[model samples]
Target: MAKKPKSDPNYKVIAENRRARHDYAIDEDLEVGIVLMGSEVKSLREGGANIAESYAAVEEGELWLVNGRIAPYAQAKTWGHEERRKRKLLASKRELARLWNATQRKGMTLVPLVLYFNHKGLAKMKIGIAKGKKHHDKRADAAKQDWNRQKARLLRDKG
Candidate 1:
């Protein structure tokens, strides 16, 4: 008989850059791997990480994650990991080239949208290839959101 695979545990998102969606017009997205030490991974498992201030940087043909803070593990040994070290993102050479070219345009950037663990328990980053939105665009988005909220409330009240 074939054995069934183990079910995946629920994902608990530690932190997210919600502002990314409102501030940028995300045109495309890609999943990328992150480099981390043992303690850093442990910290992430505990949901004590923040990517709000983080941004992806391309330098010397390599992609790096900057400003992402994974707090040091409390139980780690003396030689624990650095909290804000520049970690390399693992992506195919072709993908790297594509992102590099895309970022060359003014006001466009690669932003981390979300952080979560895969079914197999590996940490993953959802990155968006996006361009910055102007002030009016953000105001319009806020108004739209408010309208949606009011519509939902009215529908509930009618029921």
Candidate 2:
């Protein structure tokens, strides 16, 4: 039998932390399942999630996503989930151990890059192992991006 492709058309992105790339130098990334309540899932499907201030932490040999906000479902008045609850992330024991070890290094942290529903309709979080960028590093990166854009525009005009 032929192997199947990894990406499927059914997958849909719920929210992305675009600032993650600007604020941190991402080293590695992995997708992990997120534990969410029914109302939270519904809210996410309606495009209501904010991972801007969220980070992942390993505690008691398990990974947990912290500070992520999943807005309450509009129709879930009495049964709405908390907006900023810590959600558990599902990963293999080995993967969890590796992440824990990497986080032990100075200035290294786990940042949630994006939140999306998989092809199977299950909520997942793409977490990255990143180091926070310094003020100068951020400025340099912005300069490089500006230069790249300018170069692209110049080439397009010349062509």
Question: Each candidate: what lDDT?
Answer: 0.85, 0.90
What value does the lDDT take at residue 98 in candidate 2? 97
Candidate number with greatest lDDT: 2
For 86-110, candidate 2 gives per-residue lDDT tens digits of: 8999999999999999999999999
* Candidate that scores best on TM-score: 2
Candidate 1 stretches with Cα past 4 Å from truth are 1-7, 151-159
Error of 1 at 46 (Å): 1.1
Predict model 2's lDDT versus the native: 0.90
Candidate 1 residue lDDT tens string, 20-54: 89889999988788888888889999998999889
Range of the 10 consecutive residues with the lowest summed lDDT in candidate 1: 1-10
Can you give the lDDT of residue 118 in candidate 2?
78
